[model samples]
Target chain A: GAGVSQSPRYKVAKRGQDVALRCDPISGHVSLFWYQQALGQGPEFLTYFQNEAQLDKSGLPSDRFFAERPEGSVSTLKIQRTQQEDSAVYLCASSLTGGLGNTIYFGEGSWLTVV
Target chain B: AQSVTQLDSHVSVSEGTPVLLRCNYSSSYSPSLFWYVQHPNKGLQLLLKYTSAATLVKGINGFEAEFKKSETSFHLTKPSAHMSDAAEYFCVVSEDTGGFKTIFGAGTRLFVKA
Candidate 1:
């Protein structure tokens, strides 16, 4: 709506369990990004999408970390077989265009804890 | 390759005192630099950015950063510190090489003492 929105603000998952987080970027934005932030650290880029096409997935930590923006509007990040080390905050951001010159807006983020 | 380094892990200042947060970056090409602030349990908010425009970039909340190409630094400064300014600050660098790649610094935590 007004800004980037994320779902499941907080999540607790058992080790080896699968979890999904959702993000809704600002309407009509053309670029979307996902980042992972650990305690006391800055957010690290996970992946990027230009419209519905996934142009870059190089930053995904592992194969288990999958993100998809199927329709170019809403996106989802899925983590399989979650590990304790995977616990962190997942941030979603969107920009008006697909480059670095534009200002990217961020969501509150989804906090995940693996137990 | 592009990278950003925030010099201090933590900084403490009394309310109303001058504030400074240092940042340096390395980029292969002309880089876009940015400063973002994150409050407790809140999303990141952009403070300011320096593209190819003015070297002195002003942002909201009385924050400003100057892009120095000679030293490859974009340090953030404020004339005075406010209690509300206590938060984590991050320096970011972006370079477009086929992909829009962005790198973030480790972050500096600002503590304002009253």
Candidate 2:
């Protein structure tokens, strides 16, 4: 794809249910990132991957949230036992290289509504 | 740590008026700064970025920002506001922590009144 692509653009998950959001980054990109944005707020970092390696998971809110880019291209973010507070937009971004001064491309994002 | 602060939560300007969005940042190292805009229900788009090369950076849609090391500020500005410019703007600071870890400010919602 020419840009980062995200699947399940919108989802409504019941409390205690699990949800998975998928992201396909730009081809040959070496870095991928996940962010969570609540209503009227800026996106907050969730995790980061350098190719297949999960280099940073410091921003994940809890153990219930998990992300993986097993093949260094496609990634998935899973929220287990979703709660009401989990409602937000999950954004995926990728950069050509993880190096300094690289521009990161963003996807449209997955809107999750926990009911 | 690195952090960004957007001074205003909301800013209103009449169409054709000048626009200014203030941003301040704190970083332990020389930071890479960026400005991103988000339209309603749309993904974020990069407006501009400030690398080490230039203190004044030009961006798309007639937007520009100046990085002032002494002030620790990277403020976005436009000579005139367009109706299409109404959107949310975020200030971001990226630091190298093995890889770049970007931190975003709370965002400023710009409203252009006709």
Candidate 3:
């Protein structure tokens, strides 16, 4: 079975530009999550979606960050006016259920660089 | 708030030697613990998890962790290290304070020497 996957493995953008990263979760997965990982640091939660309803967006750092999963499978994280501080890897993960203890699988992540 | 701490930023061991990765967690409520491994240029992979079922948890590739509620610790250990074990290890904690949220530690880099 195919695990979670992201598109455009690498992206470079100038500060103040807008960028979108896509994620295709595993088939039949009901839960999706987004995380941001800075160099030499662990991933930090960005948002979470259960099916099409976003259950959590508390981890999003600021208003410039946004995410959506309209069809309940694929998701996209969009950043408006990208900042130099946003240069990091954006990771996507999915799980079978919305349970707190459910095992979440991750994608290779989209590496974004803001200059 | 829930958080996880990985004591060592890096650990190096010779092949066939024992491997230990220490992790401690702090949570207001009972938490679900997990260990994830990330090879260079790869995604994170689940090694094991403790969901309040057992104190001693076993995982893949000869790995295991003991959950101590008193100490608030869930340290990962392997009897023998393999060259392939060189990677970054993260200790994670899941809590349902308001909704399901997972937190990750700083990660420990494991270097296996021949």
Candidate 4:
């Protein structure tokens, strides 16, 4: 793909139903990131991966929110026991390097609606 | 902790008038700064970045920003506004925590009036 790709552009889940969001970063990009954007707000960092290593997950809201990049190219963000508050647009970005001054490209995002 | 504050939630300007979006940042280390624009129902696009090499950074669409370290500000400016320039803007600060971690401001919505 020319840029980062994400699956399920929109998702609607019943309260307490689990959902999984997928991200496919740009080819050979060493850094991948996940962010959550509430309506009328900027994207908030959720987690970061350096290749296959999950370097940071500090921004994940709760224990039910988990992310993994097993092969370093594709990543998944899984939410267990979904809540209404979890409704937001989930964005994925990729950078050539996870260092200072690197530019990151973002995907259109997966819009989640938890009822 | 590194954070950025966008001074205005919404800014309105005439199509031909100048544009100014104010931002202030707080960081414990030398930071990397950026501006990203989001069109309605579209993904974010990078406008510009400050990487310490220059105090004045020029971005696409004739937009630019000056990094004022003493003032803790990085304000985006354009000589004239265009109707198409209406969008949401975000001010971001990235600091190295093992690797670079980025924090984004709430966002400023720009409205260009005809």
For each candidate in turn, the TM-score is 0.99, 0.99, 0.98, 0.99
Chain A vs. native, model 2, TM-score: 0.99
Score chain B of each candidate by TM-score: 0.99, 0.98, 0.98, 0.98
DockQ of 3: 0.86
Instruction: Give per-residue CA lDDT, model 1, range B1-114, as digits (tens).
Output: 999999999999999999999999999999999999999999999999988899999999999999999999999999999999999999999889898978999999999999
The Cα error of candidate 3 at residue B87, in Å, is 0.3
Over the stretch B1-114, how does candidate 4's per-residue lDDT look in tens digits? 898999999999999999999999999999999999999989899999999998999999999999999999999999999999999999999988685578999999999999
List runs of model 1 lying over 4 Å from the truth. none
What are the per-model C-alpha RMSD values against the true structure? 0.7, 0.7, 0.9, 0.7
lDDT of each residue in A5-106, candidate 3, tens digit only: 998899999999999999999999999999999999999999999999999999999999999999999999999999999999999999999887899999
Residue A70 accuracy (lDDT) in model 2: 93
- The per-prediction tally of clashing pairs is 0, 0, 0, 0
Q: True interface contacts reproduced by each model, as a fraction?
A: 0.69, 0.53, 0.78, 0.69
Whole-model lDDT, model 4 = 0.95
Assess the local accuracy of residue A47 in candidate 4 as a C-alpha lDDT between 0 and 100.
94
As a whole number from 0 to 100, the lDDT of residue B64 in candidate 3 is: 99
| RMSD score of candidate 1 (Å) | 0.7
**Per-residue lDDT of model 3, residues B17-62, tens digit only:** 9999999999998899999999999999999999999899999999
Task: Report how far off residue A90 is in candidate 3 (Å).
Answer: 0.3
Q: Candidate 4 iRMS, in Å?
A: 1.0
lDDT (CA) per prediction: 0.95, 0.95, 0.96, 0.95
